[model samples]
Target: MEMIKIENITKTYKMGLIDVHALNDVSFTIKKNEFVSIMGPSGSGKSTLMNIIGCLDTPTSGKYFLDDISVEAMGDNDLAKIRNKKIGFVFQTFNLLPRTDALKNVELPLIYSGVSSKERHRKAKELLTNVGLGDRINHNPSELSGGQRQRVAIARALVNDPAIILADEPTGNLDSKAGEEIMEIFSELHKKGATIILVTHERYVAEFADRIIHLFDGKIVSDENVPKNNREK
Candidate 1:
């Protein structure tokens, strides 16, 4: 049931003559349908770890198995294809196209996957409806509230029926009420059996996850499961 296996992963960056080690021998496993949070202060390699998990970047060394596939051995083209087919990303910035409508935004992935226009429309409409934005299908990102914009992003993320949802500080730009609403959507997704991995610095936001993995100096400092009763509070 392990969907992700990361072993002795390390990432390094070169800034001029100086080399920065973003991650160092980090290892972990994430089970399917698990809602987990990655937390750390600035420059702790949490983001670097996330990039590795999401297949946006490769590690400088070590092995990563995503759904049993060896990520480290895959070429850039293969990695891009896997990323398009398997991972769904939700960014804090609600990275929607300003000129596109909700339906269009959600359909972008399907278009890339070569889905027919008729089928694409059907799928996109269904996703928007599921995300509670059916009526706003034609609304552009500018017209929607912050929470609604995030909802559209979520819909877009789910458009391809990805195996995992990777949300990076998804509610950081929203107000408390809006943030709570976004959390509720995530809760619903988890209830319906979606695997979620979120990256955040806020303890309150991290509390929404079933387990939390704290990163410090490119290593896992703590990985703990939340008690059942404290999930929502």
Candidate 2:
């Protein structure tokens, strides 16, 4: 089943009178439960593609079918709802609320979805436990280590049971050991049938994915499956 379909997508940015093409006629399809990475150098359009895939930005002219729902024509309100319900984002900085505890942070999404307080607390606790952070559920972001903070972010992302996990430079700020631990969590998530699309410039981080999509000059340069060893590594 194709969870994502991007056809001839293009994105152009206007800087005063100059026009910059961030993506040009890029097209691809991602199946359900697939782990994929988008990699490239600076200004190579990997970020732009990620934004489009996450529904943070729409293409200039193209068709995007996310789980058979047309996203190209969605308004801001509709897109926001889809973002909350269908996509989970993990960022390099963790993006946790500085003053909130881990459990509260994870429950934030449920609040947006209009879930009851009791159910939200239950779900948040379950997710935090699943991510191996149940003991730290009451700790704020500042009280946790880099790895623990990222785990909280991951738990928050999964709180809504989104269709896809969109991670952008998720390990960028962590040390090697911390990064590996986060990747292990991602591996477990994939095993449990999460569709993951990771965007990164590090080969080591990208290697965690089952397939890699290389982007350059606002276009897809290569899309290939990773070897078994690579996937396991």
Candidate 3:
């Protein structure tokens, strides 16, 4: 089943007297539980596409469907609800609150979701444990290692059991070892039937995905399956 459908999507930004096209008639469909990566250089349309897919930004033209619902027609508030309920975002910055403990950070989403404190704590603990952070649940982000902090972010992303996970350069800040560890966690999530859409320019990281969508100058150049030989066993 298709979980996402983007058709002829275009994003144009008005800068001064000029119009900059960030995404040029982009189109793609992501099936449920499939792992995909979008790769491009800094100036490419990858980030723009991710924003549209995650509902952080809307397109200038064309249609978008999420789980068969017309996302293109949704209002701002509706889009916010969809983001909270259906999509999970993992950012490179490990965007946790410095003063908050891992548990509370993971629970933040649930708090906004109107879950009871007791239930939120329980779910947070479970997610923290799932991400190998059970022992550090009480530790603040300032006290955690870079990798651990990213793990906490991952836990938070999964706390809502979202239909899709959208990660933007999730391993960009980590060292090689930590980056590999993060990729391993993503691999585990994929094996467990989680749908993941990761955006990264790193070749090794892109290889971790089942399919890769290559973008250049606001256009998709290619979308292809990862060669079996390139796949991690």
Q: Give the whole-model CA lDDT for all candidates, comma-separated.
A: 0.93, 0.93, 0.93
In model 1, state the lDDT of residue 16: 90
Best by lDDT: 2
What's the residue-level lDDT of 138 in candidate 2?
97
Q: For candidate 2, write residues 149-204 as lDDT tens digits.
A: 99999998898999999999999999999999999999999999999999999988
* lDDT (Cα, tens digit) per residue for candidate 3, span 1-233: 99999999999999999999999998999999899999999989899999989999889999999888898878999998888888889999989988989999999888878899999999999999988998999999999998999999999999988999999999999999999899999999999999999999998899999999999989999999998788765
Clash pairs, model 2 backbone: none
| Candidates ranked by TM-score | 2, 3, 1
State how far residue 17 of model 1 sits from its true place (Å). Answer: 1.8
| Deviation from native of the Cα of residue 20 in model 3, angstroms | 0.3
Q: In model 2, where do residues sit more than 4 Å from their true spots? A: none
